[model samples]
Target: MRFVETRWDGYGFFLDPSAYLAELPRLRGVLPPGAWAFVSEPGHYDIPRADRCVKDLELAGIHPATDKSGRLVLEFAPNRFKHESGLRISYTGVRHLSIDYEHSIDWMAVDTVLLDEILPDEDGGCVHEIALTDARITVRCRDLEAVWGGGC
Candidate 1:
């Protein structure tokens, strides 16, 4: 991953689709251990509960680049327990998107993030999952660009 510094945040970096997929294993390990409802057994959550970490990140917001066309972006901000860093994921050619939330998304602590290829090496189409404390987001898109936004 290339670390590119930004003005608002101390640092920021971009990752193309391939790089994002390659980093999934490492990103899964970076997230905190989800609730017992998630773990305690294999595939209890239906898909797969990703691994664990120390600090938890929270959902900050979701933005659309335009009204027409399938383009979207989701942002996860650090809880500040330890640091001030976050992640922003941009999706293009979004064939599908589902955001199921019991309540609002503001400050909702994220449990895990999963991005699986819809079909192995097929035009970058993927199913991106954002598992949060009170919500579950799934997006199927042709391409994904991720940005790591560091320290406030």
Candidate 2:
């Protein structure tokens, strides 16, 4: 439900649990729903869906750090990810546009991680986001690109 600023149009935020929800409505105006064609009562689906791809990849669920913090972040791995859990979408005739991933990492593998210097200048932390457009698609990933910090 939270949003982070990023370098994409219309969509760009690390960890958009509802990104798919928005995408379905946006695309519905342009094309027919996917689920309706294959099966009846196609309650949910989405083409070029973001939520389906980013639901989980195991980002600490919480970073517990901020820009003011100066302490190093602890390294830890996630037990599961959204991809493994499966994403739910809304649509009838949905077709995959493309799922491009910039990075896929487990920053927890490295100790002494810092946020201010480690995370991206915008929307940094262990958070990541996926972007989908009618003409182009992008997935903003950074496995080891960012670091988290905890105030001492």
Candidate 3:
């Protein structure tokens, strides 16, 4: 799917890890164990979806952005999981992945580096920018939307 690194101002959605918020129901934690993130645009290389080279990234940490425009950057922790075609697309730009979208376990892609392959050029920030845009992200951890506030 897609990694939605958004940019917002004046009372953004995710800031504090609060359970009362409309988003982050899971307090304290950054994201869930399994999250599906990516974009609709193809990668820069000829990386097929059924390649064994794909490496899934984890939402490791969340912190402020170095850019003046961007206020934060959520680090994809570090892990890898394989994926297949059983995912259910709930809506546009959204996918429900029962399996973690970490790597091309079932040879889903040429290389799991697909997320890094496609991204809007940016120095990194916390303004609610589409970190991973136009792609379908499977986020099992609801906290992702709360911590990052991803949208289609």
Best by TM-score: 1
**Residue 81, candidate 1: C-alpha displacement in angstroms:** 1.4
Candidate 3 on 1-152: residue-level lDDT in tens?
12322222334322221221223233123322222232211221122343222224333333443444322334442223442211111221121222233222342332112232122212221111212211323222121222212220
How many residue-pair clashes does candidate 1 contain?
Answer: 0
Clashes of each: 0, 15, 51
Q: Which regions in candidate 3 have their CA more than 4 angstroms from the true location?
A: 1-54, 65-69, 80-152
Clashing pairs for predicted structure model 1, backbone only = none
lDDT of 1 at 24: 39
- lDDT (10s digit) by residue, model 1, range 1-152: 12111111223211123443344345442322221112222322222221221114556777876677788987766555532467566777787788776444344335333222222124435555554444567776766665556221
Lowest lDDT block of 10, candidate 2:
112-121
TM-score of 1: 0.50
Cα lDDT, model 2, residue 33: 26
For every model shown, what is its TM-score relative to the native structure? 0.50, 0.21, 0.20
The candidates, ranked best first by TM-score, are: 1, 2, 3
**Model 2 ranges off by over 4 Å:** 1-24, 29-53, 58-106, 109-152
| lDDT of all predictions | 0.45, 0.24, 0.25
